[model samples]
Target: MATEITTAPHDGSTDPASPARLCGRLLGRVETRLHDFLAAERELRTRVDARAAAPIDALTALIDSGGKRIRPAFCVAGYLAAGGDPASEDIVAAASALEMLHTCALIHDDVIDASPRRRGLPTVHARHSAEHARNGWEGEPRRYGESVAILAGDLALIYADQMMSEASPSLGAAWAELRSELIIGQFMDVVVAAEFSADVALSRWIAVVKSGRYTIHRPLLIGATLAGRPELEGAFEAYGDALGEAFQLRDDLMDAFGDSDATGKPVGLDIEQHKMTLLMGLAMDRDRRTREFVLGAERDPAEVRRLLDETGVRMDVEAHIDRLVEKGRAAIDAAPLDERWQRELGAMAHQVAYRNS
Candidate 1:
């Protein structure tokens, strides 16, 4: 929403639709499709009783907040780029399934991060906690809030699986692999975060499993598998790996500096929570004084800013961002891709590094 109008330059030969623009177009397509799917599934809302309304309400808020819907677009794009028909049932099924998977992840991520807001609105736990407090019927607000959020996240996971299962038979294998990767990746993320054993190597491992694979790679792979392309496998994998890291690194940057309106979460959540991000870990290892400053800083926003300024964490973080961009570019170059696909992938890589939201 920054009115700087940072549109990518294009010419007639580029079809007036750069890869980033095409990503937005494809995301719009999937968003409409998902809205229809949710409308059809709204019957589940009516089925739940009043006693369980909290979870339903939380889920509804999440659905309303929505997102970029990029994962499904990635799935569909990979499918079509590999010669799969857009109208094919398998393609639609995979795209829809990927969206559901993403939705499930968001619900769980909000809970794990203990985020009070998303999209400038109260997060599920925050909303439920407020409701509980108003009713004056709770023992502890935090306990009740967390419990409801946990159940809400569970319901989202169940619904995601249900959506995938109801898809066409041809997409079963793709769906299975995606779900498996998601679960494994999520578990790995939780373990790594909890243990605080995240160095650059561990961060890279978690990045591929937790963010890279599910967010980009697996979805693309599923789409390509649906298209029955044996040759494009390596390219798709490489694209996902690079794109996924780019996405996560961008997210880390956003957690540090993005506007609340743009990113839909409080800035500095990563610093406050002491999340083990690659940027922080790399900075810590590169400069002992920077590490000491970050460790010594208070959780207040002003103090955190001062620490970053005084110890050069911000500069170090910016350097790591540049490194990630370079790595992404190299991976895209190494992929077995033609001019059109390479251009698309390059645009995506750039977008990932430069994205504000």
Candidate 2:
């Protein structure tokens, strides 16, 4: 970690405890510390294996790329809500580790999606694939590039584990569980993509494992456990589970229809891949032409959007998001935390449900 993490100057009058302020503060600190840590690692790798360092270079570039920092923000909020020292280095490192884990997941996810762009930039696999072609590599350019991208994601996972090592044993356990579930979700994703008919139960399970627990519940649990307030686990779990699932559904809708500038990636990639999502599942069941269209090889973004709307998939998705957010708000209200934390959590839930970027 850096000797110090500097962020935009703030005063007490701004209510540092507010969700937005707290998120900004923690995200700023996490980025500063994360850069410092990666720089040191890069130096070490450069000295040991200069060629192998390329993966780490890619990893750092992805880190520097933009993200909402939602997972880390949730980590900080969990610590604060559970009455931990919000200013402590341990908390910052833990949150930064969660961000690193997210980086790993996204790198792998982009590869799985065969996505060309992310955060409005070339994806790691796509970038490396292009580089291989430019440099006149001997083997298949795509394979070489994907291989490097896989190594980069592996390094990121290692970095995430290293970041979490300083935290308590309980925190480490949560991190392990998250990674395991992520693997299971990825396996299920591959299977669903290749074989399964659209099944709502299967789709929801994917959301729960891939996005719900890994994205929110476990991160919050890590923070809360590190805060030494395990008693608040039940309420935060309820809140995290609901918010996390809603967060993912909203993302699916955005990737299907949102503008590239707003979502930071080209839209309709999921439709192009024919991945089974709740939105797609609902539409597939309700509309035959939509199912036939999406299941076939050719992708028509216009028709996908029309089906998404005409089949009421968009409205149903929105309704589910609203309901889940309400469930999270109720959990926040019932949690035995400070009133300020309650308000902040309510606001967090709102942001999760409503954010476009």
**lDDT tens per residue, model 1, 7-75:** 333333445444445444455555566666665556556566546456655665666675655667667
lDDT of model 1 at position 217: 74
Q: How many backbone clashes does candidate 2 have?
A: 0
Deviation in angstroms for 102 in model 1?
1.9
Model 1 lowest lDDT segment of ten: 1-10
lDDT of each: 0.66, 0.80
Root-mean-square deviation of candidate 1: 3.9
Off by over 4 Å in 1: 1-29, 44-57, 166-181, 191-195, 295-313, 316-323, 326-338
Worst-scoring 10-residue span by lDDT in model 2:
1-10
- For model 2, how does the per-residue alpha-carbon lDDT over 139-253 read when each residue is reduced to its tens digit? 9888987888888888888888888886666786788888899899888978897774778778878888887788778877888888898777788788888987898888888
Q: Residue 39 error for model 2, in Å?
A: 0.2
